[model samples]
Target: MVRLPLTPAEVARGQRLGALLRRARGERSMLDIALDAHVSPETLRKIESGRVATPAFPTIAAIADVLGLSLDAVWAEISRPEHDVTPAASAHTRPERLTA
Candidate 1:
């Protein structure tokens, strides 16, 4: 079956997902994480580079589990609109004081 092309939003989301995973990986080697996730290093690299934009759910779950990331949080982060601020970004912003 021929797969339909992904929308630009979907591509951006995939890139965001890859960025989040890479950040969470910190100093760990790609090979180590891939081995722990039970996926080939090449597969992990592809996912990390956003080359495989729509990876299988099981593969994502496995990687998330290995990385100790909350799948729900990952979904929430990646699902937000491009113009919206992420929780992480918002958290670092200064709060406004209420003037009575």
Candidate 2:
């Protein structure tokens, strides 16, 4: 099977996901959490570091379960559109065009 390169948006999303997971992890040791989630510590480390940008669904599910995070919440958090500026903010700033 062939894998395609990830877009910048995907990379950003992965970073956000990793940050969320790290915060949710609190003071728990990565090894303990990984063991509880039935995954290798290295895998968890990679996920937390955003090295495994798009992890397998099962792996994410397992980690979410161990961390007591709802899949819906996780999806909502990660799937939010990246808004560079609010409507009011955008009104104040001039839009710039890029020339190749």
Candidate 3:
């Protein structure tokens, strides 16, 4: 299935997510994590560089599993601000439908 297009906000969030993951991966070669997650090192590199903005859930689950991160926590951390009531929330604020 074709993945939905990401809005500017989502792109920014993906960049932030990449940054966080990169930070968390300090000292560990990308190859190591890629091997552990059963993904290609290039895939990990794309993810960390925000080249692949919306990775599959199973792919993310695998990466998170290797990083010892919770799916909920990952979602919470990357959600857009409008999805939540908090002043600085990060919920998925964009509309679900695609615009022309």
What number of clashing residue pairs does each candidate have, in the order they appear? 0, 0, 4
Stretches of candidate 1 off by over 4 Å are: 85-100
Off by over 4 Å in 2: 84-100
Model 1: per-residue Cα lDDT over 8-73, one tens digit each: 988988888888788778899999999999999999998889888888888888887788776765
TM-score of each model, in listed order: 0.83, 0.79, 0.71
| Predictions in order: lDDT | 0.77, 0.74, 0.70
Which structure among the candidates has the greatest lDDT? Answer: 1
lDDT of 3 by residue, 1-100 (tens): 9967889987877876676567667788899999999999998899899998777778777876677665655676667464543322322232343222
Range of the 10 consecutive residues with the lowest summed lDDT in candidate 1: 91-100
A best-first ranking of the candidates according to their lDDT comes to: 1, 2, 3
Residue 12's lDDT in candidate 2: 72
lDDT, candidate 1, equals: 0.77
**Lowest-sum lDDT 10-residue window in model 3:** 91-100
Give the runs in model 3 whose Cα sits over 4 Å from its true position: 1-5, 80-100
Q: lDDT tens digits, residues 11-80, model 2?
A: 8778767876787788999999999999999999998898988998888878877887766656656676
